[model samples]
Target: MSDSLLQLSAIDIATGSNPLYTVLWMHGLGADGNDFVPVVQTLDLPATPIRFLFPHAPLQPVTINGGHTMRAWYDIQHTDFIKQEDKAGLYRSQRAIVALIEHENQRGIPSSHIILAGFSQGAAMALHVGLRHPDKLAGIMVLSGYLPLVHEIRQEAHVANQLTPIFMAHGSYDPVVPVKLARSSLQLLRDYHYSVDWHEYPMAHAVCDQELIDISRWLKNILKEALISDHQNR
Candidate 1:
């Protein structure tokens, strides 16, 4: 529960022995680390050698919600369906993410063995920071996510994540972050020569069962890849 760097509280979960993988999950606006706890357990990933790090977002004034103070990674411009944007908040959040990455590295988790993921606003930050950082992480999972900094990212994305596998899922009927946004973002990433795995669900602004299943399978695949790479290195 330290405010060092990102003001994040981190926990490590080990299954058998040494940690096999580290999955860092960030929650949506107004949500806390507990938001994804259900998904973590529902997936029954406790048996896997994965270290789940769910970081809490710092409380902030959300423009989209009448400036209510909530656990937000950043701020939105407004609640108007058309004027909602969060670039300023995202910039701050990315700095926190970079600091969080350094902290994770200090904890003995190699970037090659880490997975960056998020939901909603958190997902937007995930896409921003996960792709631009100088190091290559194992993977990036964006669930029910929208790309907030597409223009800046188009100008700023580094070559490192061009090959880093990204698994993103969104819901078609989502009124919050429209599915069109996600699809267009996927196209943008592809246009940028990024390796991305994209999928669409039938729900609205949320994680559905099928998406969860897809995420679980995708996680297992990346974990397998991590193990293969680790073994090859040894």
Candidate 2:
């Protein structure tokens, strides 16, 4: 699957005539890319031109959900996410996401000017793929999700994103992905010395108004820094 081209469908949003920065945002399990479209409109972003890509995950059977087919990045074999790992599905989706990043590169946006982000299962993908991506990225943003395939990350993580900033937020009352799991992931990243900015909301399994504000601020800051770095390198 890694060698094959991915034909995943997506919705594109360009904030200006020519976008200088790109964000690849993935949706949660069972949901399409359109899940987070409305949230983008609520963010108070900077004046910098940006392009946002929301890609739909491929349809697959989820074992934990009674083998029901849905749009999931990987299959969940059990409620204990760490127990039964889906290596094949995770790596396949990682390659598909890498294809999207490469697509952005072909369209004139460098990896340094791109941000990979997601929510829930999508968030897990963002952490999994961004860490292993061979090129430097602007940043990674994760919301209401835990890290998957944690055991393999240390060996497989690329050096390009070793210092990339990470923004993680979670709902305090999230039942789907317990806040404890999110905290453990944060701790793991920190233990590995990754730069992580963490936040907790008073909601459950979803984003809130304050979380959107924080996301906007983080995005603007990273983009601003990326623009500066790009100019300096040129």
Candidate 3:
């Protein structure tokens, strides 16, 4: 609802050209839109032009960080994340993210051609918003993040994306977001019959090369249609 949409950096096709698809990515706590810019380059994507939008979270005081102000999707009230949730902040960011999705719709990219992705706190946001999004999406990618609002996701999650593919990856040795948290989230999605392509790497909270390879492969599978369409036009 605010000007959060303006706080984004996009890697787009050439001027005056419209991309057939878009990937709206979000950054983790304390990071800005530039955090994942380099990751895009490493992805072995389809030939079809794809736009990537990295939106920055609004600067706010994070309680877990001793009230230090930083760019975070929501305020962490406690170390035990799900015990006491930030419902207000979560919904606030959700509206902002929904606005971003609508902005893409106005630019001629339908929800079906867009992928929602994020890492850490950003990943949590992506999962929260993407599930409740009214329209079907290409897919949801979660990197080192867990599902929030689990108690209400069943009631809140839209039916449109129930069948949407989900790609989730996490590190086994992750201290920040414990691997068990990610696993439980995966189990919850499976319990609800959501199609999830899950992966685990032997690393820390950071991403590994193998994980990137897996992510690239998953993206190719999701966007293969665009690749085929682009080839026909060429």
Candidate 4:
């Protein structure tokens, strides 16, 4: 639980632009924070100066292998309803999320200017942590990701003021996590009274062009609203 500074690192594009917002993005299993750098660039972020926090997951043993050290926000164990637990992985990454948010606060960015995002396993962590965030965030983006605890989330999720706007996208042909699973996840959130904007692209388990486009649009809306809210609060 002590500070290790190992959660996520950042890539600063558009250095000339005043960093107006912070986005904490996590990578999929076995990958580091750098995995999503391409997507960041593809967003065509302007010099408006946005800080991208690409947190590296803790190195731990994966179930796919004999306990080896690799980047993973948590372990997947087995898909059984009772055994689909992340245990230490989730708690450790949660602490890292806390550290990252605190660091952003020190940088003069408020919680309203922060966005939490991730893909695959990282995406699950994003939802788990972002939903439980005591303060409202600029937004929460989940790509090819599902809820870590569907039942527990509905029971415990909270936001400060505005409803937590979520963007959920999946690939129709995704075999790694399966597109149907993503759809089911979206439906479940909706059934639970969560606000979610859902999308599906004809691709595999990885990100696609349509997904990126939607994400960009989603962020633009959230950023615009965040700026307005900031000014109004002032």
Candidate 5:
């Protein structure tokens, strides 16, 4: 990992040895990389080792939280996300994430073998950056968050990931990031004919056991497909 690109330290976990694919997961606002560390063991994945990279978001003052400094990808100006988005912050984080992807590429893992996963604010960043990423990715997993920069995504989305599989899981009783926002993002993706696997659980702004099971299945399916593609290309 590049210290300049990723200012904060990250927690690295591998299911086993000889990892073939990487999942770069980001945490929700105010949380560090360790936020989702425990989930690694909970998901029932295949026997093959999978690398999970959880990077800590940079510390910055969040407007919605009374301008108190916290670890967030970007600042949330108000409750209405469509208005007054923190574009500068979002783009800054986007570049940093791209650099992280490049770092993974240098480690013998191609862009197509990488997955972007995140929660809440981090999920927003994943949807924002993964779609606009220059190269194709294995998949994107969004948990309990809405897509940021809704007006700009349509114009800025890259053609490389036009058909990339997206797994969006939201909570029906989410108080932080409303389920309605997630559904609206889903509707937009569907409108553009994007392949999105949407799931909703009757819970709050948090991950559930059933969601973890579903995520494990999704990871296995996508990673298996990526491995096949890798073999065919070689």
Candidate 6:
């Protein structure tokens, strides 16, 4: 499918008047944008105004789930996720997400003022796309997900976001994506010299209160730096 045809429906939340930053957060398999909406209110963000876009993944038949139709960024062929990859689905979703970032730029938010984030399958997409994005982004936050299409990342990643700050958190007891897989992904990024801030929570394949607090603090720092940098550039 064409990128235009894959246009996603999203939930938009603005934190204050004249928002200066934008956050595009994606949800995991079988979930919609509304999945993370409640977490927004809990984040202890800075006083700066911010806008959040929670986009619903396209509906597709997931193979691992007995070909059941559900909202997924891409298909999961097997439990051994690294072996069988979904290149086409990933590329399609990447284009759709890039379109969302461009939409924010069109609305007056620079790419540098945007942060890409996700959980589970959504977190995989954040890592896949954010690294390849041609423009510099404020940062990327990934929770409970592993890097997909690993072979292509080294060749496809863009220099613009090479040094972009990355916040990665994984649950130690994540049965779905496995803590080991997440750690391997982290090692790959680190081997490539990516600046990553890592955290681990003693939970499952889900977000927790402490994770929310850490995310809030990380976002606060990132946006604060962005604001300062933007002011200096003026």
**TM-scores, in order shown?**
0.90, 0.97, 0.91, 0.89, 0.95, 0.98
The C-alpha lDDT values of all candidates are 0.79, 0.92, 0.87, 0.78, 0.90, 0.94
lDDT of 4 by residue, 29-133 (tens): 888877887777688654567878787777777775566768787777775412668656676787788678888888787888889999998888888888888
Q: Model 3 reaches what TM-score against the true structure?
A: 0.91
Error of 3 at 22 (Å): 0.6
Q: Report the lDDT tens digits of candidate 6 across residue range 1-234.
A: 556668999999999988889999999999999999999899978778899999999988999999999999999998988878888999999999999999999999999999999999999999999999999999999999989988898999999999899999999999999999999999999999999999999999889989888998999889888988888999
Tell me, by TM-score, which candidate is best: 6
In model 4, what is the error at residue 36, expressed in angstroms? 1.2
**Which ten-residue region of model 2 has the weakest summed lDDT?**
1-10
lDDT of 3 by residue, 26-67 (tens): 889998888888888798776777888888788888999999
Using lDDT as the measure, name the better of candidate 5 and candidate 6.
Answer: 6
Report lDDT (Cα) of residue 69, candidate 4. 66
Candidate that beats the other on TM-score, 3 or 6, i.e. the better one: 6
Q: Candidate 6's error at 45, in angstroms? A: 1.1
Mind giving the per-residue lDDT tens digits that candidate 2 earns over 19-97?
Answer: 9888999999999999998887788787778899999999888999999999999988988888888989999998889
CA lDDT, candidate 6, residue 119: 95
Best by lDDT: 6
RMSD of 5: 2.2
Candidate 5, residues 22-98: lDDT per residue as tens digits?
99999999999999999998888888878899999998889999999989898899898767999988888988888
Residue 214 accuracy (lDDT) in model 5: 96
